[model samples]
Target: MSKAITNNQSVDLISDFKEITKMRLAVSVVFSSVAGYFLGAEVIDFVELLLLAVGGYMMVGASNAFNQVIEKDLDVLMDRTKNRPIPSGRMSVKKALFIAFTFTILGLLVLYIINPVTAMFGAISIFLYVSIYTPLKTKTPLSVFVGAFPGAIPFMLGWVAATNDFSIESGTLFMIQFFWQFPHFWALGWWLYNDYKRGGFFMLPTGKRDRGTAIQIILYTIWTIAVSLIPVFGVTGRLYLTPVSGILILILGLGMLYYAYKLYKNRDEISAKKLMFASVSYITLLQIIYVLDKYIRIWI
Candidate 1:
C-alpha cells in the first residue's frame, strides 16, 4: 500500500475504535465508579482508584462494542447510529468481537486485583449489557429496565472494590442510579423516538411519546430524587449525608424535575432534549457533591 493510503487507513482505524467503544460515554460511566470509590475508601489509595477507573472504562467499552456488533443492522436504520464503526462498514464483526473479549478479560483481571466480588460484578455487568439487555432492546421496552442493572453497577462496583463487601451503602448507590436512569433515558427516548423507531428500539415505556410516557418520566424523576437523598437517613450507615448536602441534592433534583415537568407540558422534542440534559447534569453534579461532602466531612 502507498504510504499516504496507509496513514489514512490508520486514522480510520483509530476513529473506528472510538466509535465502537463509545469513548465519551465509557469515560462518563467510569466517573461514576470513581465517585463510588471515594465514598468507600477510608484513606484514598490513588492506585486502587486508578485501577477502578481503567477497569470500569474497559468493561463499559466492551459492552458498547458488543452492543454495536449485535445491533449493526438495526443501527444502520437510525441516523444517530448509522455512522458507527460496524454499521458503517468501518469495522468487521470478527475484529469487534476480539476487542470485546480482550476488554472483558483485562477489565475482569484488573477488578479481580481489587477484589473477587468486584470482578464478579464486572462480569455480571458485561453479561447483562451484552447477553440480556442488548437482545431485549428490539423485543420489549422493558429492556431499559433490565439494562439499568448493568448501568447501576459501576457506582456500586467502585464501593465494592474499595470495601470488598456489598453493604446497604452500596445498594443505596445502586438504587439511586437505577431510579435516575428512567427519566434520563426516557427523555432521550422522547427526543429520539423517530430515530429509535427506525432502528426498532423499544425505548419508551408505553412505546409512544404520549401523556403516559411523560407522566412516567415525571414520576421516575421524583423517585430518582428521593432515592438520592436516602444517604441522609441513618439507614445507609457509613454513607452519611449532611443536611446541607441533602439540600443541595434536593435543589439539583428539583431542577431536573422541573425539566421533566416541562417535557410533560410541552410534549415536544425540544422539551425532551432539555430534560435529558438536565438529568445528565443532575447525576453528575450529584456525584461531585457526594465526593466533596465525604472529603469535607472528613477534614472538618
Candidate 2:
C-alpha cells in the first residue's frame, strides 16, 4: 500500500511536469529542428543530432514554462488553459520557475557547445517568447506577429546547428517558416477567440470573427505558398527543390489554402478548426517532403 502511494505520487509529478512544459508542443519544436538539420547536413552525425534535439526541446520547454508563470492568472480565466499545471494549482510557481531557470541555463550550455550562433539564436528565441511575446499577448493583437519570430526559429536553428554558419539557405528556411506561422496561428486564434477573450487576450487581428481577419488569413496563405516554392527557382543555394518535389509542395499549399478559403467563406467555428488542422498538416507534411527530397537527391 505504501509502495502504491509512492508510485501514484511519481505519476502525478510526471503529469504535472508535462502540463507545465507542454510536452507535445516542445516535441514538435524539436521535430522542426531535426528536419532542418537533416536538410542542411552533408553527412548525418547521430551524436550531434541527439544533442540538437535535446537542447532544442529544453529551450522550448523552458519557454512554455515561463509563459505559464507569466499568464497564470489569465490562464485561470480561460477554459482551454485553466487545467494547466500552474493555473490549476497542481504545481507551485516556485517549482515551475526552478524548472524554467534550470532548463534555460542547461539548454543554452548544450547549444553553445554546438556553436555560438546556434546558442545565440536559442537565447534570442527564449527572450522573445518569454520577455516580448508573453507580456504582449494581453496588450495587443500584434503579439502573434512578434511571437512568430521565435516560433520560426527552431527550423532555422537546426540548419545553423548542422552547418555552424548562417547563409542564404538558412535565411530561406527561416522566411518560409516565418510566413507559415500566420495562417497556422490565426486559424487557431479564430477557433479559440472566445477563450482568448475570456483571458483578456488579443489574438485575432480584428479580435473578432470578421471578414477582415479572414481576408488577411487568405492573403498570408498565398504568401506562404509562394515562399515555399522559391527553392524550385534554383535561387536558394543548397536548398533547391526539384520540380517534382515543388509540385508536391504546391499541392500541400493548395490544400491548406482551400481550408483557409473555407474559413473565409463560412466564418464559423467549424471552418476555423478545419483551417487549424489543415495548417498543421501542411507544415508537418512539407517538412517530410523536404527531408525526403534532399536524401533522395543525394542517393540518386
* lDDT digits (tens) for residues 211-236 of candidate 1: 99999999999999999998898789
> Which has the greatest TM-score?
2
Cα deviation of 165 in candidate 2 (Å)?
A: 0.8
List, residue by residue over 1-300, the lDDT tens digit for candidate 2: 999999999999999988788999999899999999999989889888998999998999899999999999999999999999988889999999999999999999999988899999999999999999999999999999999999999989999999999999989889989999998989999998899999999989888889999999999999999999999999999998999999999999999999999999999989999999999889898889999999998899
Model 1 lDDT on a 0 to 1 scale: 0.93
What C-alpha lDDT do the candidate models reach, one value each? Answer: 0.93, 0.93
Model 1, position 240, has a per-residue lDDT of: 89
